[model samples]
Target: MTLTNRQRAVPPSMFADETLMELPPPVRLTGIGLRFYVDDEGRGSATPALIRGQLWPLDTAVTDATIREHLRALVKVGYIETYSINGRKLLALTDWPSVDRGSRSRLPAPPSTEPLARSSRASRETFAVEGGGEEGREDGREEGAGEGGRGPSRDARDETEPSPFCRKHQPHGTDFACGGCASARKRHDQWLRAEAEAEAEGLAE
Candidate 1:
């Protein structure tokens, strides 16, 4: 399917969506863009190349790999559901509301046999910490530590290490003044609050 100029509604609640808020900025933007890019029934191609071409044709910076990463993030948060149909991968929004105007989607429906891999709230938070940005070092080693440990040893550094640095705020030298880290902390606190409220509501119901 090709990209179309179809108009779609953007609900105000989208801005307050906890799951979307937890994702990286680029991933969140891509998720919102996909909402407008999909068909009336919220079905669309899952191919990274097609997604990049459809959503970011003019933007040279947005690459297929970037789109793929964004899509993976979106799927993890349950903003979209991906499935394979006859070996062709497609995606659909998990909670697409009914629309009156357009015809039904021509895309094949997702199979009912397999369950969608929607991450729980705790898992989502873990994912954010690990993959949200440059916060957590993959190797668990400081950047530029030599092979022979010329710099501070891991045990010595662990005692003085502050919060990890965010992608935007880096090389702060063990300081907890990173704006990205602050923002991430705020989002995480908000998620905790929301989870508590939701649990309370569930108990009351």
Candidate 2:
């Protein structure tokens, strides 16, 4: 789906790095990291060490692996840039778009976020129920295999409502754009780095 900045959701503790790892899988950890990026620094940009001391609660336990996993998820999502600091891996959010704000291009590249894989017929069934097929079934009726083989209840279907990852959200390109290799993007420009800097400074179009 097309997303304006307001429509996009970034979690609060995204920069928590390691501490986030302690939270339950997926959402909480990601949420913490999100907040860290957008909140603590006021820049949505941070290094793990730069953030650790600031994010922890007065008594929250700590570990390096937690920070690493948080960073790993961010890197996978394309929200952050990564590098090596001496011997340790480091990460920070993308400070600015590769080009100007609202600057139309082919399509901006989708972040490298890894899609979690779900296996198991039962699990797949659960996912399908929760996330509708490409058609996006709000009415919530399964077309096949109801009681013994009949369709599902309207209520059952409704309860199974799919979230964004529902097949419906991922169309060919309108949801995003192509990155030449089937990856998604807005567009590309040789001078993109310059444009990004100017935009970051609020001095460019």
Question: Candidate 2 — worst ten consecutive residues by lDDT sum?
Answer: 178-187
Candidate 1 local lDDT, 1-205, one digit each (tens): 4545676777666676655677888887788788887888888989988888877888888998999889888766557778888889899876567888877889986652122122223433453455433553336533333243232233432353233434444455224232245434443454445445434433454
Q: What is candidate 2's lDDT per residue for 1-205, written digit by digit as tens?
A: 1112223344333443332333456435443445434422223323554444444334245444555565665444434545543445444344332322433422222223222121122433664576567563445544433343223333443353322221222443233321121212311221233234323432221
Question: Number of the top candidate by TM-score?
Answer: 1
Model 2 misplaced stretches (Cα beyond 4 Å) = 1-47, 84-90, 95-205
Q: With candidate 1 superimposed using the best TM-score fit, by how many Å does residue 21's alpha carbon deviate from the native?
A: 0.8
Scored by Cα lDDT, where does model 1 land?
0.61
lDDT of each structure? 0.61, 0.37
Residue 175's C-alpha lDDT in candidate 2? 32
